[model samples]
Target: MRDKLTTIGFDADDTLWHNERFFQLTQAYFAELLADHADHDHLMERLLAAEKRNIQHYGYGIKGFTLSMIETAIEVTEDRVPARVIRQLVEAGQEMLAHPIELLPHAREAIEAVAETHKVLLITKGDLIDQERKLAQSGLGELFDGVEIVSEKTAATYAEIFDQYGDGPDASMMIGNSMRSDVVAPIEAGCWGVHVPHGLVWEVEQAEVPTSNPRFRELKDLGDLSALIDQIS
Candidate 1:
């Protein structure tokens, strides 16, 4: 498998470092801020809906999520959301954007191990500024041969990425925590997909594991990635 795989792409968020957990923390804070206006569960549902609808307009990242929080507040409060609450929402997002990067267990080692054998690319989606900042702060910036900060992860996006940086789909593999973005889509693009389960995954990113797909694989953690690659290769 490795001989066939000339390029290995890694998802930057939960796969490389801590990301969704910070978003979850901010969401809890958001619920607290809007507690007087709506129930936590209801507010969360509205926020998710708002995020999905706004993804086309705002794309993905802290900025879009912060906007969604404000929009949800307005909707839940019937447009009576307090000015202070809105300010706090914006502050919460800023705090998230400024948060420090914390690499997940074995992230660096796995990348180093893989990089020794193949071209390693950091393929992530989000606000370009935030993603680049995280990469810089992660101290793993020098490990990757390339970095792709994309707006969305889809089959076409994967295909394009492989076309530019890899030896076509058959010789590329994408590893990440999201089944939708990391596994299914890349496989559909004609590349292998590896799912490394993360402790925290956003609701929107969750999907049933495609265990039946021959090109799909799931690992308990990235620590096992090197061994898995060696086995399959």
Candidate 2:
């Protein structure tokens, strides 16, 4: 086993701070707006499907989210829907941009504890400006040694970053909430991966929960993370 851990990569959005909750709240409002046209469950299905299909075309962030909402409204709304309904959707998107940012449970203390022994790096994916604003407001930005805000996370992404930083699989780890994006991608890239479940996961990012991977260990929250790392290290 590797005795020394040199670099640790972390996913920022849902991992270090609250994120999907805002999206959920926005979606709930959307369901109410279109209640006359379709039921809540069907609206969610259309919205989730649209999001997945538009990942490349719309990219990620509030812009994509807003556009997805608009598309869903168009698809599900009754014939000749009022202009005010469209305006309402647009306004909701703007509201999302102004949504207050909150840190996740135990984020600060866990990052602080891990930073003492590892060269901590923040690897997150989203709209550049929005993410920067969130990190700046988060107050935990100063706790990390490096912050990488990317448009997406993949095996190639991890490999390039690890190679450029002069760290390999054994001495580095990727910590985040999304199983497919965070856990699977980094581990496939040859780095240790730790899975931390979040309160809300967007339907676009949801996948089958894997129960069989020695390299992947599940933890309750950031508070328990430091001790887990200490044991493995």
- Candidate 2 Cα deviation (angstroms), residue 28: 1.0
Best by lDDT: 1
Reference-based TM-score of each model: 0.97, 0.93
| Candidate 1 local lDDT, residue 13 | 92
lDDT at residue 226 of model 1 (Cα atoms)? 91
- Please estimate how well model 2 matches the true structure, expressed as its whole-model Cα lDDT: 0.83
lDDT of 1: 0.91
- Show where candidate 2 strays beyond 4 Å: 1-3
**lDDT, residue 179, model 2:** 88
lDDT (C-alpha) at residue 49 in model 2: 88
TM-score: model 2 vs. ground truth: 0.93
Candidate 1: minimum summed lDDT over ten consecutive residues — where? 1-10
Candidate 2 per-residue C-alpha lDDT over 147-203 given as tens digits, one digit per residue, 9 for 90 to 100: 888878888988888666647665778999998888888888877788899968876
